[model samples]
Target: MKTVLITGCSSGFGLETAGYFLKQGWKVIATMRTPREDLLPRSEHLRLLALDVTDAESIHHAVEAAGPIDALVNNAGIGLLSAIEGTSMDLARDIFNTNTFGTMALCKAFIPQFRQRKSGVIINVTSTVTLKPIPLLAVYTASKAAVNAFTESLALELAPFNIRVGLVLPGLAPSTDFGKNAASRMQNVFPEPYEAFAANFFANAKNTAVVTYAADVAHAVWQAVNDPSAPMRIPAGADAVALAAQSL
Candidate 1:
C-alpha cells in the first residue's frame, strides 16, 4: 500500500485529511506538534508522530521516523491577523517560520527520496488570501504566497524526476480553529489607529455566508495526489473557487 505523510494533524485540515486518507486505506503517517491517538480512529494503517515543523531538528527527526512515503502534505501552519503597523518583526518571522520555511524545509527533506524513487506528490496547503488580498493579513498572505510561488517553480524543477508538486488554496474555513488560533497570535496587534477597521473586518468575517470546510481541502489533496493531470493550483472551497475566477 502507498504511504503518505501529513503535517499538522492536530486539528483543522490536517486532522480531516488524515481521516480521509485512512478511510481510503492508505498508510498514513500523521504528524503534529504533539501526537494524539484519540483524534483519529484506531487503524493499523495509521501512525502518529510528534512534529514541530519550525525546528530543523524536529523536522529532521520526523522525516527520519516517517520512512519512505508516496506523498507529502504540508498542511501544517499558523495564522496571524494584524495591521502591518502593529505587526512586530519577530511575529512576522514566526509566521513565516511555520507557514513558509517549514513547508520549504519539509520539501527539501523529501525531494531526494521522491527523486530517487522517481514517483511522489507534494501538496502544499496555502490560503486563498493570496488571491484576494485584504487588510490585517499582509504577513499571513505573504507567507502563503511565497509557498504558492515556490510550489509553481518547484513543480517545473521536479517534473523531470516524476515528482508532482501542486498547491491547494483553501478559502476562509470558519469551522476550523483558524480564526481562534489567529486570535491568539493577534494579542495587542491592533493598534489604536487600526482597531476600528479591525473590528469591522472581523464582524464582516463572522457574517460571511460562504466558507471552506476541512473536507473540501481533504478532497483537493486527494485529487492532487491521485490525479497525475491535476493542475498546479486547485482552489478547495466555493469562495476560493470564486476568488480564483475573479483573480483570473
Candidate 2:
C-alpha cells in the first residue's frame, strides 16, 4: 500500500482529504499543530503527528517521523481578509509565514527524498482567489498565487526525476472555519473610506449560491496524487471551475 503525508489535518480540507485517503486503503500520516486521534475514524492505516509548518525544526521532526511516503499534500494554510492600508507588515509576514513560506519549506524538506527515489507526487492546496482577484484579500491571494507559480516551475525542475507536482485551487468555502480562523486578523481592517465597500462585499458573499466544500477539495487532491495526466492546476469546486474556465 502506498503512503501519503498530509498537513493541517486538524480540520477543513486536510481532515477531509485524510479520510478520503484512508477509505481508498492508503496509509495516511496526518499532521496538525496539535495531533488529534479522535478526529478521524479508527484505522490501522492512519497515524497522526504534530507539526507547525512555519517552524523548520518542526518540519524536520515531522519528516523524520513520517519516514518515506509516496505523496506529500501541502494543505495547511491560514487566511487573511484586510485592506492593504490596514494590513501591517507584521500581519502580512504572519500570513506569508504559514500560507506561502510554510508550503515552500515543506517542499524543500521532502524534495531530496522524492528526487532520490525517482518517484513521488506533491499536491498543493491553494485558493481560486489567485485566479480571479477578490477585494480585501490581497495578501492571501498573493500568498497562494506564489504557490501556483512555484508549483509550475518546480514541476519542470523535478520532471526529469519522474516526480510530479500539482496544485488544487479551491473556491470560497463558507462551510469551513476559514473566516472564523481569520477573524482576529480581520478586526478593524476596513478603514473609514472602505467601510461601505467591505460591508457590501460581506453581504454579497453571504448570499452567493456557489461555493466549494471540503469534499470537493479532497477529491481534487486525490486526483492530483493518483492521476499522472492530471493538469498542473486543478480547480476544485463549481465556482472555482467557472473562474478557471473564464480565465482561460
Candidate 3:
C-alpha cells in the first residue's frame, strides 16, 4: 500500500483528504497541532501525529516517523483577511512562518527520501488568490504565490528523480473552518475605514458557487497524485476554475 503523509489534518482540507485517502486503501499519516479527542475518524490505515508546520523539530520528527512515504501533501495553512497596511507585522510574519516557510521546509526535509526511492509525489495546496489580486488579503495571497513558484521550480528539479511536484488552487472553499480560524488568529482590532471595507468585501465574496467544498480539493489532490500526467497546477473548486480561466 502507498503511504501518504498529510499535514494539518485536524480539520478542513487536511482532515477530509486524510479520510478519503484512508478509504481508498492507502496508509495515511495525518498530522496536526492540538488534535481533538473527538475528531478521530475510524480507520485502520490512519496514523495521527502532532505537527506544527512552523517548527523544524516537529516536521523533522514527523518525517522520521513516516518512513518511505509515497506522497506528501502540504495541505496545512493559515489564512488572514486583513489589509496589508492594517495587518500587524507580527501577524503577517506568523502566517508566513506557517504557510510559506513551513511548507517549503517540509518539502526540503522529505525530498531526499523521494529522490532516493525514485518515486513519490508532493502536492502543495495553495489558493486561487494568486490568479486574482484580491483587495484585502495581500499577505495571504503572497504566501500562496510563493508556494506556486516553489511548485514550479521543484517540479523541474525533481523530475529527474521521478518525483512530481504539483499545487492545488482552492478558490473560495467556505465549507472549511478557514473563516473561524482566521477570525481567531486576527486579534489586530481593525480601525476606521478599513473595518467598513472588510465588511463590504465579505458581503461581496459570499456565494455558494464561489465556495468550493473540501472534498473537491481532496479529489483534485487524488488526481494529481495518481494520474500519469497531472498538470503542475490543479485548479480545484468552481470559483478557482473560473479564476484560472480568466488568466488565459
Candidate 4:
C-alpha cells in the first residue's frame, strides 16, 4: 500500500483527508499538534503522531516516527484575522512561522528522502484567497500566497528528480475551526476602515453553503497525490474553481 504523511489531523480538512486515504487502503500517518483519539476515525491503517509544524523539534520527531513516506501533505496552519496596524508583529511572525516557513521546512525535510528514492509527491494545502484580496485577512492570504509560490517553484525544481510538488487551494469551508481562529484575532485586528466589514467578510469566507465541504478538498488531495498528471495547482472548491477561472 502507498504511504502518505498528513499533518494537522486534529480536525477539518486534515482529519477528513486522513480518513479518506486510510479508507482507500493507504498507510496513513495522521498528525496534529495535539493528537486526540476523538478527532480521527478509528482505522487499522491509521498511525497517529503528535506534530506541531511550528515547533521544529516536534516536526523532526514526527518525521522520524513516520519513517519513509511516499507522499507528504503539508496541512498544518494557523490563522490571524487582524489587520496590518492592529495585528502584532509577533502575531504575523507566528502565522508565517506556521503557514509558510513551517511548511517549507517540512518539504525540505522530506524532499531528501523522496529524492533518494527517486519517487514521492508533496501536496501543500493553500487557500483560494490568493486570487484576490479578501479584505482584512491579508496576512492569511499572503501566507497562502507564499505557499502557492513555493509550490510552483518546487514543482519545477522537483520535476527533474521525478518527484512531484502539487498544491490544493481550498476556498473557505465552514465546517472548520479556521474561521473561529481567524475570528478570535478580530478583536485585535479590526481597525478604523476595516472594523465595520471584518466580521461578515470573515464569516462569509467559511459559510459552508457559500463554499465546498472539507471532503471536496480531501478528495482533491487524494487525487492530486495519486494522479500521474495532477496539475501543479488543484482548486479544491467550487469557489476556488470559479475564482480561478475568473483570474484566467
* Residue pairs in clash, model 3: none
In model 2, the number of clashes is 0
Worst 10 residues of 3 by lDDT: 185-194
lDDT tens digits, residue span 1-248, model 3:
99899998888898888888888899988889876646657677878888889988988888787878999999999998887767888898988999999999999999999899899899999998899888888889999899999889999999999999999888787778988889986666365768888888788878445668898898998999899688788888887888899987
**Number of colliding residue pairs in each model:** 0, 0, 0, 1
* Cα TM-score of candidate 3: 0.96
| Residues 132-234 of candidate 1: C-alpha lDDT, one tens digit per residue | 8698899999999999999999999999999999999999999998878778788899889888999899899989999899999999999999999888899
- lDDT of candidates 1 onward, in order: 0.94, 0.95, 0.87, 0.86
Global lDDT for candidate 3?
0.87
Error of 4 at 152 (Å): 0.9
- So what's the TM-score on candidate 2? 0.99
- Quality of model 1 by C-alpha lDDT: 0.94
TM-score of each candidate structure, all chains considered together: 0.99, 0.99, 0.96, 0.94
Query: How far out, in Å, is residue 208 in model 4?
Result: 8.0
Error of 2 at 106 (Å): 0.3
Clashing residue pairs in candidate 1 are none
**Segments in model 1 whose C-alpha atoms lie over 4 Å from true places:** none
